[model samples]
Target: MKKFILILSVIFLIHTASAQLYIAPGADLRLAGNVQVTLQNTDLINDGAISVPATGRFIFNGNGNNQISGASVPYFSELEIAKTGTGLLTLANDIRVAGKILFTSNLIDMGNFYIDLGSTGYLDGEDENSRITATGTGEVLSTVTLNAPSGANPGNLGAVITSSQNLGSTVIQRGHQSQVNTHGTGSSILRYYDITPSNNTGLNATLRIYYFDAEKNNLDENTFELFKSDDNVNWTNVGQSARNTSMNYTEQTGLNSFSRWTLSNAAAALPVTGLKLSGQWKNGAAWLEWITQTEYHNSHFNVERKYEDDLNFFIVGRKNSAHPGGNSNTLTTYHWLDHPLSNKGPVQYRIQQQSLDGATAYSNIIAIRPDVNSQFIVSMYPTLHVKDGIYLKTGGLQVEKMHVRIVDMSGRLMMTREMNYQSGWLKLPQLAGGAYKVSIKSGDHHWEGSFVKD
Candidate 1:
């Protein structure tokens, strides 16, 4: 019962009259065809090997739940998938190839599978070389596994996994599931193997898994967790690794196996540890300040403010991040000022920290009630006067009562008066004037101006 079909070094053709071919599970077969294979079903448990010629096409109809548990033998020639149905093809086993593996199938289910590539192998869809594309309407989960050469603790490979959204271009990688909340329509999930650096061997000496949001931007490191699986059914938490926030990628320190890896839960994360943010008001302006005890690839800070009881905030100012005394461990201080807060009520403030790579975080929101008097603008005129008298003007949001006081440089009170008009004129007693300070107080609002009489 030796069930094997070897079409080696010969021109072999497989053209079924009914446009369909079915191979049983127990039939262990090997193929080296030079023609197109259409409408074929190699049922479950068929661990056959395929070796198509350079000009041949091994086409599979993606209609039913197809399974490919075969190797590409010595090399892969032209393997095509005609996406005629809506079902998925699960690569339950490894398919090591050194040639092209194209997919016409709209979707390839990989939530519990892997596409293990040879040391010099890569996957190519119709869009680009070294890319695996998804053209389906439903969500597609894809993961690529790479192992270090010679089974080293940490190795590298030259492989690229690229896919677009179901509609447009929203490329996502491991650890960015949070993006699906906003950009879920045209999105696909991509996962990769993480590797460390020891005896560097491959072209790209590092195996990195980039985590990006639905907007094609790198995701923050603190927003996700990493997990690994051996059987693809039961997964184990591998703990989140130290991320390169400025680069929006996490580098696995001591991983070398060919297991399935994933990045999940990409929601908003709190400010990094040892970060302190505060706000204050001075001279009719709101000032925001933050201090970080340590930093890593920190990019910039955005200051935002929200009106009373409003949950949404808008950016009002931005400050570039600077290291503390030329290093990252020292306490770094940053500040920004937002003058004339929009109509003076209870204003809330928060700082948004953005890393150079694309990671992001937010500080605790702080609220401050600005002085209602800030809405009133006070102005006074006249330096050297005798009869014209000094004019006092109070504009913007009229006040019921405003008290004015004139004091000498030596703290001697010269005159005090109260007015209710929006504009008024005051006559000060004749005095040997060198410098004097005029103070105006209206409710909780106070303003001070200076003048010198000759």
Candidate 2:
């Protein structure tokens, strides 16, 4: 544990036995203005405070697979990654960059950690071969204030926005994971952008999304069209105003509000619309039913079910589309019964519509506690919001306490807590903006619901 304070401009280098420079807790490492600190073939473990002046630069370069991990996040004025060979920089915690992130060589694998760029920050030298990527749930976020901005790409996060009205404080988040829609999952490219503005309405805006060919995630770029989503669970096709295949970007205009956006195949449609799922207990069995407003080129519908403890959904049954070959403009209903239910706690169900073209889409999930009394009910309010907490209410049930568990879409447990309940507001953890499942259990009654953090 060593404390280093550099007030004078200097170049600091560390060559250690473990190839790691450790800044222990309570230690302070400060860089003077105009200082440049470079770590070559080394990793950084900073559990202490590290401060860099506005003009200081912190560079990580070498041929080693290095990592930055600690209880404390490192804030830098300028950060550079110039690793050679197959070496990459990985983040074990979130980091903030105020000046610039110079990506000269390989990639920065952000695994469940974020890279926050200040208002003046921007990415530099990022190309098809060298850029930021994520293997898990991580993102790169930038906040900037724009008034009638023209072709402004904040942090170069790849969503170039142009508008004739003031946007005020805007937040742009770039993630590497594919998005899920009313259809099952994996319906988008590896890149998606979540854009939020303080002044959201009445402003006609044009957005141009830029992407690297390597980030297509096996999708055909020629069919890419712009899609926008309010909850990231359901998407609406915002027709592409223009596109450049050679330049690898798509543009859309006439947008009044902004939210989650991504590119997907324009021809890839499930051919079914207004899908709804519901379930109830009937004659000692769980009766599930679904309705679709319109169907065209629909092949079949797969009924999928999962229990409270299940990590993945399994196809329980399949029903052929009412109009498999022809088109149906009227309503179509399908039903399935789960006899002799094994799990009495809680069960969730969804419908997957498969078209003749082999495309798929999903329906909203419905959960039911078959064993609970008819009068007992559990509900969560504001299922989608930008707030930090969600309220849960147990109606008709005198519940004193309950156990709650929150898990990400990947089934990774994010948090677990016990709270006194009847109706209460539960404070959520510092979760990244995405969809999460919350499970609550009290005695024999169990409930599962999902929410989106915008």
Candidate 3:
């Protein structure tokens, strides 16, 4: 028994000497100051909290395994898993860093942990700032945590992280990364991150992004794009982020699959100022009215609507913007009327602003329902004045034939036309500028409408 106890003591002492880590009960092992710790060809195990300061550097460079459990606070410093050997580091704790945490050519197993980029830290491929660049093909079973920046300097809030390897998940708290504002007078600001969402969650994987102006106090009305890519080079604008009013943060949720997300203010100076859309039931019709503040290189506005169960929005009306004031700083008011064939229970409406250069943006979505009884009815397009012909739809109702007539204000029939059940359009004869009445009849069904000829 004594011989066996001696052998066990020897083994414990050998491991204690080889590890070289300060082990304590309920105390953290810290690598502070300008300390440089290198794991050349062996595994390093730490059971207590591991704290590394900004001036400290931790390098893993061997074929052995390194495991850190309790908690790791690498505050605004550099940590590298070098390319020398097949090093595998398992971090089970929640790590908070403000500098670079890289995997040059090794592996890092996060074991479903969280890595918090507390103040500022990015993953790899950075030029002027610290980056988190992981070039290895290793697997990361970890989640990224991004806190909201509440400081005066917004540039220290957001992270510019990019990884060649796929990431598991990301959580963003409400925060601001303030870049100096040259708003209304300078080049637009842009920030983008490249990441590949693991197919483990399929395309239903969610990425939550919280955004606020880093330097500016109030959130400016700006445009942001969420882009996705299969190859890191080619990108597709998946969708736009929606502003969350309660949190005062632009929260972009519902990102299923992605290779990257890029947010930019292409037309930052062309502030939206104010945008509001409301619908009301008036004389069996739904009236939609909206107002816009500042507009630049504005082309037109498209009124779009969707039903409760529908996932797609259809353009219902169009209003040309004659920003007559030309890049006006004044408010512009617009209106549209929707005469639905059927009064649906719930319907959503929004305005799509198209720029002269074909770029487009959307206003906040508004949902409203008809106050009166809902039923299928025939409706027409271009209910307002038009220079060309008009389209009439039966709201998908069955009609043997359609008979249409146009008359002048004096009640004299100016023209008459007939259409089959599958017909779509009715051409009108040129008339002087005046209001006219249009009547359509099919068996017992009848619809009387009016329009102004331009």
Name model 2 segments beyond 4 Å from true: 1-13, 267-274, 278-297, 300-352, 358-454
Q: Write the per-residue lDDT of candidate 3 for residues 1-454, one digit (tens) a residue.
A: 5334533443454355354333334554455589776655434444445566877776766666665554333333666766345456665454555676665665555554545554365445322222221222212112353232122112222423322233344433211122221122212223334343333233333343433343222324345434343543323334444644344233344444455444434343343435567777677677888877555566788999887546799999999885752255456788898886453345688988776777666777887655433422345667677667887655445556778889989998889988775537777797788888887777665667778878
Q: What is the C-alpha lDDT of each candidate?
A: 0.49, 0.81, 0.52
Ranking by lDDT: 2, 3, 1
* Runs in model 1 lying further than 4 Å from the true structure: 1-27, 40-44, 48-57, 69-78, 126-454
User: Per-residue lDDT tens digits of candidate 1, residues 175-217?
Assistant: 2122121111111134333332222232222224543333233
Tens digits of lDDT, candidate 2, 236-282: 66768898989999999999999999987644533666678898877
Backbone clashes, candidate 2: 4
Q: Which whole-number lDDT from 0 to 100 does residue 46 have in model 2?
A: 85
Candidate 1's C-alpha lDDT? Answer: 0.49
Q: Which wins on TM-score, candidate 1 or candidate 3?
A: 3
Q: Which residue segments of model 3 deviate by more than 4 Å?
A: 1-34, 39-47, 51-276, 292-296, 305-314, 322-332, 341-348, 361-454
Which pairs of residues have clashing backbones in candidate 2?
A: 182-362, 183-361, 183-362, 184-362
- Count the clashes in each prediction: 3, 4, 13
Q: Estimate each model's TM-score.
A: 0.33, 0.66, 0.37
* Ranking of predictions according to TM-score: 2, 3, 1
**Residue 414 error for model 2, in Å?**
49
